[model samples]
Target: MTIKFRFHPEKAVEAAAILLKLHGKPMKYIGLLKMLYIADRLALKTMDQPITGDRYVSMDYGPVLRGVYDLIKGQPVDSALPLWSKYISPRDSNYVDLLQYPGNEELCEEEEMILKQVYETFGHLDPFLVEELCEEEEMILKQVYETFGHLDPFLVAEWTHDLPEWKDPHGSAIPILVEDVLRSMGKTEEEIEDISQEAQREAYLDGALPKIFG
Candidate 1:
């Protein structure tokens, strides 16, 4: 059986914003992507639902939220691209910068905590002397690359590659179904069945809402 969840773009952007804010500067887009994927995985394991509700795919870097990845690449995934772009800049030199604060209204307290914890584990930037860095203008980009290594994007990718749910796509993208993740998390057949049914119901409601209220 196929399982799908309606992607919530606001939550996705807010999650990214939260991470970028924690980093306090432009971050390697890859690092942001990895942290978002890890947060979703953790949420799935503990909360029984992914925080972003995004479609997942195993890519060369690791598992990624397909819609968010498209947004990062400046593809219009949906109306949410404007929302994402408003708070986050397009990819620049392999990095993305936060343009402004995007409030986490769609995220709950637990979700915020999870994102923060994920940042601490994988992307928290240490306090650095801005004035000292300003003096070394020529090394700014070099510093970013060096700092990013310490921020753990590559490390996170390697760790995620070790997950049972992650498959090496061999340079091609492979869909990572929610059922696949559930199974990897040791969810029972009955539980997966129930979750799939619930997802179907949610999708139906998502479709009917606009028609019903419009």
Candidate 2:
């Protein structure tokens, strides 16, 4: 049986918020989505768990986190849980702006560091920007804007395509199982079994303990 981790929208929101804070302005939704996916993929490989626990899928762009994608598009979701719209603006011309600061209480130091490093590696590097006379204008234009008049989403997508776990889904999408990723990373079957069981246990705690304790 395929093992799946429960998606936590709160963590997803907090993760995206951290990236947005580092971005310091509106970002193309696609770019933000790619950054999140890369971070989660890295987390899974290193820590045996993804940060948001969102379902993964392979699409034309690359591997995507399904729940986070839905949240980015502002689709109707469980209202009881924290909505992505609470902290991120509705899509405006395919770009999303951070609406407010969703506190990072759910994120550990390592997760936050992963997010920051992903942004640095994929998003933009301002240190390479050419210095300008006007300080404010330089700050605004410090980051390189590729074809999209901002961070180039396509470039980020191209990089994500290189991940071994991502397969070309042609015109359709395909689910990417967590086991698939672990195996691609050369994890032994025994190690994968242990990780999957741990994931199931974590899911149970997240779902059952709240009701039992409350």
Per-residue lDDT of model 2, residues 1-214, tens digit only: 5878877667777777777777878887888888778777767776787777888999999999888888777775565134677788888888888888856556665566666666666566321111111222112211212211234678788877888889999978899999989898888999899988998898889889999999
On the 0 to 100 scale, the lDDT of residue 84 in model 2 is 72
Each candidate structure's count of clashing pairs: 0, 0
Tell me the whole-model lDDT of each prediction, alpha carbons only: 0.72, 0.70
Candidate 2 segments exceeding 4 Å error: 80-82, 125-151
* TM-scores of the candidates in the order shown: 0.86, 0.84
RMSD of each: 9.2, 8.5
Model 1 regions more than 4 Å off? 125-150
Q: How does candidate 1 fare on TM-score?
A: 0.86
Q: Would you list the clashing residue pairs of candidate 1?
A: none
lDDT of 1: 0.72
